[model samples]
Target: METNGKILKAGIILIAVLVVLGYLGVYLLTIKEPVFIKHYIEEQIYTGYQQGPRQVDLQLYYITNAGDNRVVSRVDFPEYPEIQVPASEYGMHGGFMTYTSGPQQTPGSVKGRYSMRTVYLGFSFEEDYYEETIEITKAVIHLSDGSVVETEIGSVTFHFDEERSEVLESRGGSGSGALETREFSVKEDIELIEVFSPILPVIQDSLEMKINGRDFKDIEGMNIEAGETFLVEANTQGSRGSQAFGEELRYLKFQPKLRFISEKGTEETRILVSGWYPIPNYEFIEIFQYLRQKGAL
Candidate 1:
């Protein structure tokens, strides 16, 4: 009986030792293994080549891990967010074009700058959307620990057309007959790049205007007040082509209508984009935060 008890005790000790060894192997292989994960960027700096008026390619990129997992992302401007580029600063020969007020043909573009240090990316809105730049209007990023970082996604500003042409809006002079006519000095290549009506559907025919005073025998079908420079465009036949093309739009033409009116009256124009316009300002901290939240950097 004593010999059998000794053998049982020995076997129990051996099993306990084997169990401890198995646990140690697992701990060393997985539980205690150091994970060396890092963020790898293809380019330290990003530049977007100009595509056309009111549109540019953001150079989309993919986030990849050593395991070959990937996520795709691209930069974009907010929908009709208010843009305020001051004149004499962002190269705005014409300054501060807002949805409610500002110069016609305000120039600007939205750009993005990314960083891993912050929870967000950086943004720069410039005047001449064609120029290559490091400045951005939005910034975004994320870290390994699951902490998020980001900033304002993008911005828009106004600029004056250096090549703007002169025009005349006249309604009859000293004449027995009453007449109204618009005259243009030359062609005005006003590019309407983006539109945003957050509160309403993106209506293509919400307003109307006549370009270069070419036609306006009382801009019928509008409820605009006489002597009101604002001409409400009830029909934007010219912009329809752009709408049909959708995201594939390159450029479109617009004849400047001196006046605009909407069925709602007191019409407002909301377009947001980024680029150095009028001048340059280095304000792009908010955009970075936004990018991280969306997992776009």
Candidate 2:
């Protein structure tokens, strides 16, 4: 009985060792690489890519170095979520992508290889209805092995035409020039990109602007709806006349506080997207909290 007990103990130890080895093998053999999507990127950088229920074309390029069985399956854009297309439509007929935003155009000759192939992946929008300029920097690629990849497609813009109009009421002269306020309602959603400050004044100590009553964050771009409030304290220049010889010949000087794009149509305000996410101003936030604690804001 003692000998049998000893043999049973030996068997248990061996099984435990085998199980650990198996786990280690599996872990070491797993793949950990990202898929890639490329375009026939020009010096133009794909400007005015467009909002679609309409079709457009580009030499869809792809690279799948993810794993042994991995193959390009699909490509898509996040900003315009409606657009998605198969990785490659390779058959006896050649190109597989037959559909686009509206019309069908034969894809150019397939290019590149398995490790890094620049094939003409038939591409188009499934359905997108948007207005204004869009910045495209990333593309998500789907792989045949059931994994997804987010790769850079470089900088690009969409639907970038605009219209500008004077719509603010100035109350009095204060901050840098005159304090201006606009009580406006958006007919649709407005995605704000920048707070347009005509002339760059030494504005560090002064409050820049506020939207929906939030305070350094507006420069990062935001979204708003009806009754959206825009408040600015200064404008160093650009008002036709005050009380001078040109008072009668006033050149309606106007400066837009919030530069944005909405569903109704594209309005004025030159756009510059520095970063997508907000870069928090810790000092400003802390100061604000302290001020509110003393009823200073």
The numbered model that scores best in TM-score is 2
Off by over 4 Å in 2: 1-31, 35-53, 60-69, 89-94, 97-114, 119-130, 160-297
Per-model TM against the reference: 0.19, 0.30
* lDDT for each residue of candidate 2 in 182-293, tens digit (9 for 90 to 100): 3444445667766643221212223234444655344456776654444343322223223221211111122234567765666544322111111112243332333234
lDDT of 1 by residue, 1-297 (tens): 999999999999999999999678434322111111111111111123332343221221212222211111212333323322211211222222334464433122223322111111123344453343222334332333343334343222222232212221333222111112222221222222122222112222422233333233443443323334322222433244323323221112122223233333333331111111111121334333333333433
lDDT (Cα) of model 2: 0.41
Give the range where candidate 2 is weakest over 10 consecutive residues by summed lDDT. Answer: 271-280
TM-score for candidate 2, please give it: 0.30
Model 1 worst lDDT window (10 residues) = 271-280
